[model samples]
Target: MAKADMEQFIKSQLLKADLIEIDRQLSVTGINDMTSMLLLKQAFITVSNLVDFEITIRSIYREHEKLSSEYKSSSKNYEFAKYLRNKYIGHIKQELIQKSIEWKPELRYSLKRIDEPGMMFIFNLFILETAINTYVNDDGSHKIFESETDLKYPPDLKRFLIYLSSTVRSAISYLSNLANAFGERVEMLDASEQKIEHWIAAGETRFEFIKK
Candidate 1:
């Protein structure tokens, strides 16, 4: 393959590896009242991973102008995600932080408030709203919340997590297909297969295909 194609293929594969890690971390469950703080941390990590995935996808789009239709359709999600990344995750606004504290005075009592389930739920909900536009009711009206209790421990938390996982898996599948397509079109470096086999044999056993 040409040097440019080789570089692109390698980058795509790296991004695929990242998505795999993100998926694994996000798949961890068993979040109950006792583990709420841990769950919040995991959820925060998942959202950060998702933002990184969006950024990587955007980079790929810039590198290769032509992409599949499904990839193109995700542009809107990435656009909103970029906004959320900057506003909430990447560079949180002081105003927002102050508001959060004012809304929950207990937040001022300890640093652990950052990992509180309620706070984390709001952050996750913000990201989800950005990605999907709006949260709504069956009547096509926007969902309204009067207080934290109105959210009721985020009843849709599982659904949001499932959506995030599905999105990552779909992206990985697309990238895998793209890599295979490129492989069929060009001869890889002679040592590539051996390197892959060695890496797999060295105990990356979680990848079922590699073990196969």
Candidate 2:
């Protein structure tokens, strides 16, 4: 590989690495802002974050087999990130999802059982103890609850955001360090004299963005 190309590859990866954090923060905000009025909007934020998160990570490995292998070695989250990207933030494997997609209806007391027996009177009551829109999308990918074991969260989209953030948030610094290290190895070049051809796309390239 050309030194310039390697340099650019690393540089590009570093840029994407920064994006992963931005995506995480934005998704967190969405989760925090979730409400009945903003359900779809908030859900979209999470889904959007996941798609971008996966894309940024995937781009790091593109065209550069050697570096990608090294990059992948640093994080156990790579394959899982790809799986999320493949689903485009909507689809998770239906079978896996189906297995994990069980919700126990909140045990309700008849205003009398609130203190009877071993019933713990949990003072917090969700007024909007409502539905779970856990349906398969057109692409057949499952979402939300297929991830972590916390199914009591209710909202499918919010659940997905929490799960995705959990997986990707921990790796932000790890991937960024890899990119920064590679960037350090790349020789500084005059941008005006830089040849476009000198930069390789690195790995399997995808030009198509995921359809919403």
Candidate 3:
């Protein structure tokens, strides 16, 4: 594909879902922000990989063009040969897109506020949110500060922090494996059964052709 064509195609995918107008003060704001950031980060990596793919494709075409010119002869069928080359190029491009999509992640994030609070719950949130910080009573609510507290994070924040940390690690690993699979990436919105059926059909056909 042309550079402009590839860029436009990639841009359309990114623009499909965007984080807009977030309610920052809401209780669920933190989880939303984290999810948005993760999605954006994944998109960024995919775009970078797309660029690498474009460069590789261009190089292949340049080499193909050189060889095509060298083999052209009055007796040799140049038009037929060119058609074969173009078909091969299209197949390669499809494979590249499929691989890139497979590697992407299916991420889900959730947050629930506990109305029935306890001393332990409060401590855990405090610890995770403000690591190594000591809480102080201020206006009947607990507060932790950087300069005053011996620890920055309190125990209350611990569970949240651990959850976020493990989530990030798992997401990265899942994405890496998915990308390495070298197949079309499915979206959360896509019908799972239909997609699987298509893949099975394609795989069978490909296997049959290879055997022949």
- Ranked by TM-score from best down, the candidates are 1, 2, 3
Q: How well does candidate 1 match the true structure in TM-score terms?
A: 0.53
Show how many residue pairs clash in every candidate, following the order shown. 0, 9, 31
Q: How displaced is residue 95 in candidate 2, in Å?
A: 3.3
* Candidate 3 structure quality by residue, lDDT tens digits, 1-212: 24444443344343222211221222244432335433423333433333334333343334345422322221122222122233222222354333323332111111133334343233332222232221235643433222433122354344433433333333333323323221222232346446576678777774334561
Reference-based lDDT, residue 195, model 1: 67
Q: Candidate 1 residues 78-118, lDDT tens each? A: 34445445555566656556555555554466556658756
TM-score of each: 0.53, 0.36, 0.20
| lDDT measured at residue 205 in model 2 versus the true structure, 0 to 100 | 62
Residue 14's lDDT within candidate 1 is: 71
Off by over 4 Å in 1: 30-67, 102-106, 109-152, 192-212
Single out the weakest 10-residue window by summed lDDT for candidate 3: 103-112
Q: For candidate 2, write residues 49-134 as lDDT tens digits.
A: 43444455454454445545544453444444444334323443454333322332344333456566433212111211112223
User: Which residue pairs in candidate 1 have backbone atoms (N, alpha carbon, C) closer than 3 angstroms, thus clashing?
Assistant: none
Report how far off residue 178 is in candidate 3 (Å): 25
